[model samples]
Target: MIDKQIIDSFKNLIDGLDVDEVYKKAIVDFMDTYDGNNTNEFYSMLVAVSGLLVELKDLRIVEHGYNLIEEESEKTQDELDSIIRQFKDLNDGKLPPDPMVSTLEEDQVTD
Candidate 1:
């Protein structure tokens, strides 16, 4: 069985592999500021897990026959926004933007 830390590290590494310079920077910036010990690495794990969830959902869409990316994106965004709000609410309502990097941007960076 893969260790949680190893999984997390791999996730973080994948998350940081975004091609779009700006998006890559955004994700990295968040991970960089993340307080791993504060909430048992909740924020960091949230980012990684959320991303993996999106990918898995996408795969299901491709294999199981569904076109729910738009709907799923909205729902996911809502949840992410709420999480951002939680951090902001605890920190005087100031919040950063999305932490996930765009695959389009990453592809562009690669090409």
Candidate 2:
């Protein structure tokens, strides 16, 4: 299953991107439709969507001759890189175990 940490990281990465509020919302809404059991497919979809957002931002800057927000493009790219790294760590079994999982296990034991 796709873990909660990955979902939260993806949300943060999307929020950090230089996109319009409407577009961002749309992206998040679309992400919600994915089945969390398939981590590889989800990661691939996220990469594609992130690339599209970057391309759109770059196009906007070119068409308008100035960035809508200072350093937005660079910031978005950096966040994307971070998100990708997290995904890799997760796939390699390098990510720390989720705290909630441990908490739940404790609760079950006590019950």
Looking at model 2, residue 13 earns an lDDT score of 88
Off by over 4 Å in 1: 1-12, 15-18, 40-111
For residues 1-111, write the lDDT of model 2, one tens digit per residue: 887777878988898888898888987887777567778888888888889999999898796765545467888798778767777888898874543242335567642
**Scored by Cα lDDT, where does model 1 land?**
0.61
Candidate 1's residue-wise lDDT over 10-31, tens digit each? 4576465534455545655655
lDDT for predicted candidate 2 compared with the true structure: 0.77
lDDT (C-alpha) at residue 81 in model 2: 86
Least well predicted 10-residue stretch by lDDT in candidate 2: 96-105
Error of 1 at 42 (Å): 2.6
Clashing pairs in 1: 19-106, 20-105, 20-106
CA-lDDT, candidates in order = 0.61, 0.77
